[model samples]
Target chain A: MLFDKFKPMAEFQAELAARDVVPFGAVTEEIISATEGVVSGRRVILAGTNNYLGLSFDARCISAAQEAAGKWGTGTTGSRLANGSFEEHQALERELAAFYGVGHAISFTTGYAATMGMTATLAGPGEVILLDADSHASIYAGVQLSGAEIIRFRHSDPEDLAKRLRRLGDRAENTLIIVEGIYSMLGDVAPLREIAAVKREYGGCLLVDEAHSMGVLGDHGRGAAEAAGVEQDVDFIAGTFSKSLGATGGYCVSQHPELETIRYCIRSYIFTASSSPSVVASTRRALQILQEEPGLRQRLWENATRLYEGLQGLGLPVGPSPSPVVAVVLEDRSQAINCWNALMSAGIYVNLVVPPASPSTNFLLRNSVSAAHSTAQIDTMIAAYAGLLEDGLIRAR
Target chain B: MTQYQQYLEFMLSALEARAGAGVTLSETTRLVADIGLSSLEVMEFVEKIEDHFDISIPLNILPDINTLGDLARKLQEVDS
Candidate 1:
């Protein structure tokens, strides 16, 4: 009976197998560069990976990782509350805090853990969480585990948020408003300026998840809050090293002194092992590079605009705006699958998102552009989609 | 009218608007199986109900709801 719940997934897997199409989790045999990889015995452009700044293969980051590993051995071997509280972890925390100009910073083993821990622990039963309707799965999981009375507003609609807050009345002060800097699915930036204005009127703690927009937005690359000039109004800023920093970790920075105390109460942080020395080292190097080189961010935006314009020129249905993420919308699931397979055959790799996983009922062929992508690579991706359009695998809106 | 009855009436009209004018809707009418509402449609319907009642329904309650009666009763529980 417990296994019966997986029947739908099993059926889907069987269908894919029958079609000889592996859309999800296609393995990469070799990573030739930040922009290129070998998959299914064919070289393809790595467009689906969320390597926004493309510092994964940087020489400085690699050297820093090697040096840290040589000096500190391999893993931390324990949780931060136990024997895993190494000097490197604390240093990275301090560095993140300094980078955000916040009072406290806490790191987690994975980005999911950071968001989940913060969301679950920040508010408890008898409290409320007002989140965007199209929030990430991790945020949804956090709200469920928190036992909070969760309310979802229409996506990016500040008026809807204001209405919900009004309904809460005096209880609004006890609520936590969660929104992302750049929504991962559709590449739409949250109207943080309007959101912060609403928060000012309603009075609630604001938490912005800057996972996708941390290294891509803002003059100093802080995140959407910074770009919106609402950093002072935001109570907490959660972000990930896995995206822009090209490493594996997540963190939450806040100006409130209570975050230092809250870190001890987070079960995910206490129970999970700390990030390894090498990862911390590389992340530190990547953060430095992010600050030192503004050209990477510029290049990333240029590449994003190029890909978005290219698709739009071909009359493809793309996302609302062009950031580093550009997803083409599709109404037909089978047609989406066919286009994905065709792109792969044409030496390109992208993420195929279907219902529920996609923000809406429609499917999405998600592409994440990186600063490492050359102009040629961007054009090649465009040409592949054009071919799909020519072959009638996809149609314009 | 009882709160449950009011909720049922509202749900019936809503379902009728989507399913068709001549459709039948009872308290026991299944939302998905009988009326054929997709997940997105269900969420949209819930939002409409929330706005109508001026209530913030917790998403935690959706999984337990199968029929119009279940939704109405759950709505009454939240309203209380």
Candidate 2:
């Protein structure tokens, strides 16, 4: 038994099972139907997913991906160091760098990889990472991988950041300040302008992970940095093609030409296989469509606003305003599980996030609004939530 | 307040609040088999310490932590 060595995790596992929050993935839209699609059984609405842009099924994007595979073969077969850099990959990097209006950009195989490569490469032993308490697991894992001292401020509080930063004294110059454009679990925006101003005052570099917010924020969809009007001021912008672009991969763009220099030094990028040519190919097209079809941004905001309004009107614990993400906050873990299970049994699906994802237990019923979902689809979702409330399966906010 | 005394009161209130029910120990309490704190609750206690003392408690220090005094001693060391 690895239990002889790792005794405690098994205890945690038993707790998880008993809590009614199924740790295994079979409860909802990601359900397994034995090769038959859910349509043959019961139609399910996928709200728990992070498909913010909903371009995954776009005919053009899919066709372009298939076309690229025909042209470029299947896999890259190696890391980007040697035989892996495709015309698609190079072109995608160029398109992304131009998209963010930054001088250099590097793509990673996954959203996790982008964050790990930067945080681990930049900070090492004896250095510090000033992180938001609410930052994602990838960010936390990256800080751990970096071997840096991870210092946290209160969530989204720039005053806490400033005070904690002041404690590092002369070592502040060796600091990497990290925050999210929009926190994943909480569905809240950071005070980026205020946070950036403090980092600037203290002469620290800022790495903003716009994973959840990019292509959903700003009129132009540059991300929360642009939305906050600090695009030029931030040292690095790390975002996911997975979320807003409706594809899988991540990238970090920076004003520093030395940004590319980190690629050579970072182990995560150097060791792992590069993203498949098809993914890169699809993402490049997604970028083009992102700029051309600004109407998608408008539609996304419209859906998000509608959901926010519906939830708020229900007098639930919705987010403060028109965020692309909406969450119904709950306080008990069993209650959260009951609500999530009820949502699924009613053909609606949303993520049931619990702590360590957050401090609160019945934390969030996180639902994302996407461009592909129709007004009727959104209305159906709102109606389902209203029904959930009426059923008393999920408590009223 | 003695560092140990201040530590105990904070731990008692927060541990009682965050850990879901009353504890079976007092100021001299240890944090292992008696209470069965999940790793997360242990982390929460550490985070409370971090916030109270205005210091960064690296995650690496956690697995070895057992007794309340050990935690209090670590907090005092960090504070100094």
Candidate 3:
């Protein structure tokens, strides 16, 4: 049978069904209020969302989205190469390029496509791609599409990367090294300075995916590249609007004048429909908010530290640092599931990540902090976790 | 020892570092279940071998490889 090869997956699903825990495909009943939602018939605090700046429900952003939808209709209805590109889209691109202080910027439908399109088109035949071992799935998919030789250096180890690039020798000229600003699963930031140094010494293009770092790092929130003072060193910066921007789209900005060439070459850009008018409008407003209000970033980091310290105070295993994303490392899958269920029952929502997606073999309970979370809400979340620990629903390391 | 023999020994040493002291490794040993190397681990090991030999093995050659013997033979072929 055509489906016979997936017996193992079927068995796994059956096992999960018997356990009454379908961690995947969980549905939210409704979003009752900002940073509060109804899930599984209860009001839950949304601690697992990527709304870092918490601009998703901002009055200005909402108003812009509504006005844009009323003015330009909903979607572009065509690929950029055809009739999809609108004046608003180009304006957003210009705003983004100026935001990053780059010469050019290109927008895509989603952050995944930004990485996919840029990596897929940038490196060609006979070229090589050396990426961090713990890069996001979008990066892996992009490399696979490029049909270039893929080499993975040790995660965040510039020494290992240097060795690989040195081994490539003159072929390093055609090599593209990819890394991320903040790894989503573990919430660890990259050592961009070290990586940028390696790229400077070795002749290779450096692409930094700042999907999780933009609006969360640097004084101007340009991400790890700017935070590390290596903005000039990085050749390209890829980011998404879904997280901090409070919209749905992806963009790549570069100071390189040739970045315009990607518009004609990237398949993902040329084939798929552009972002909706509402999304572009809201994203532009969100960008303005991100810059104008630095307190949002400050409050976000404060909330992050509070949450990280709170989790640590409970003696639970946490990720390395206090970024917007805080991952609670678990010993096993059963333990992770139990903890997730317990948190859900307590009206606190968080994400449950397992193997393949997780950098290590262990499961992770990922909590993403936002600026909108009140001090009382943060304290409430901590108390819920404390209750879970007291009830023996979850364990400390 | 021949280059293939030396390479095999080096590969076995790297595997033992991860698999611990009691692992039984041979040229005919399956790199997956028998040695307990995940797909990602196998790829990393293959990359190490490529670096040691200063040869770029096409990614297409991966699936055809299962055992240490197969890897050694492929390395020899590429080097020659």
Candidate 4:
């Protein structure tokens, strides 16, 4: 039966219960403040959220969202191809294109939808899509839905990619190379310069997913493509507002004026309902803040470095380089779950990433730093890791 | 060196280029454990081997091949 197909979820939930740990998607009691939240009736420091710029609680964003809600009401309730194309939505798209210094932009309900619409429309049967082996699952799903021949190259290896393209011969012209600005799991920056160079050598298009890198990299916060000085070389750039902008939506920007045509053809964009008025408004405000205020980026980096170095001082296996995200790698599932529980008990909230979803075979405690975090809050998170280390709940790498 | 030996040397050098110059590899080396290669890196190594010989290594054979020696034997079978 249809219900029988979900038996594995039941078994997984039972296993998590047997381990006496909080299951995934545990509801918070309340958001105490911007940087703190109440989970299971305890005040916990929010270190797991994707509020990178920490604008979710910004006064200007809230005011804009409220004003838009009052002016446009709650939801659009229709697709952009139909009646859902509000004035604010078009305005956001224009603003986004200008912000990224691109020729065209199209916004979507979610980041997943942005990539889904792109891949499902970009390539058809017989065409090839070459992507990083460790690309996000959304990219995989997008390719699967597109019915394109999916080929994976070595992660961040340009020479390997060149070899694969050389094998493809003339089929290389139809290839689309996809890579992320910063991998979500490892928080490591991509070698965009080398990848762009390879794309130039081989006849192919390049798409950079900057979902995690936007508002965190570059002087203008245009993401890793801009930071690597290969912005003009990239053909497509997909990003999300949920992480840095503190809103729920995604967008694809390109220097090609033909990109606007996707709005009419892509099923995900044409059939699905557009983003709400408040989300669009708030996202626009946050985009302004992301550009106007460089101090937030500086504070975010400072906090990230402190947290990363602090975890290293405690002998933990943190991610390679310091970014807004600082992930601690664990050996096994039991160890990961145990540390997650220990951190929870100490009033620290972090993401528990397991196999399959994790980039590698290891479990991870994904910690994201926010610009809103104070020195005291950052200190508390570091001390929690130190305590876990002292208690032997976790070990050095 | 023989053709197979040259292929092995090429594979070792490719792995070392990413893993580091200090790394050492032999025919019996485990791709994941001994050399510290991620799943992506392993797939890339397989792709390089496939392109080198122009033979597609079926995914069904991946699970059985643990060491570089096993991979060499499998490639030999496919080559023949």
i-RMSD per candidate, Å: 1.1, 2.2, 3.2, 4.8
Residue A292 displacement (Å), model 4: 0.7
lDDT of 3 at A165: 91
Per-residue lDDT of B23-66 in model 2, one digit per residue for the tens? 65565567855577765567667777767867767664555567
Question: Estimated TM-score per prediction?
Answer: 0.98, 0.88, 0.93, 0.86
lDDT for A145 in candidate 4 is 78
lDDT of 3 by residue, B12-49 (tens): 88788787666778898888868888766777887787
| DockQ metric, candidate 1 | 0.76
lDDT (tens digit, per residue) of candidate 2 on A46-100: 6656777777777778888999899888889989998888778888888889988
RMSD to the true structure for each prediction, in A, is 1.3, 3.8, 2.4, 6.2
Rounded to one decimal, what is candidate 1's iRMSD? 1.1
lDDT of 2 at A331: 80
| TM-score, predicted candidate 2 vs. hidden true structure | 0.88
The candidate with the higher TM-score, 1 or 3, is 1
Which candidate, 3 or 4, would have the higher DockQ against the true structure? 3
Give the candidate order by descending TM-score: 1, 3, 2, 4
Expressed as tens digits, the lDDT of each residue in A1-397 for candidate 4 is 8899689678878888997667397679998666899886678999999899999888899999999999999999999988999999999999999998887999999999998778777877888888887788888788777777677776888887888788788988999888999899878999999988888888888999999999999989999999999998999999998999999999999998889776688888988899999999999999999999999999999999999999988889998899888999997888888889889888899999986778878899999999999999999999999888889988877
Choose 1 or 4, whichever is better by lDDT: 1
lDDT of 1 by residue, B1-80 (tens): 99999999998887787876555789988898888899899999999898898888888899999999999999999888
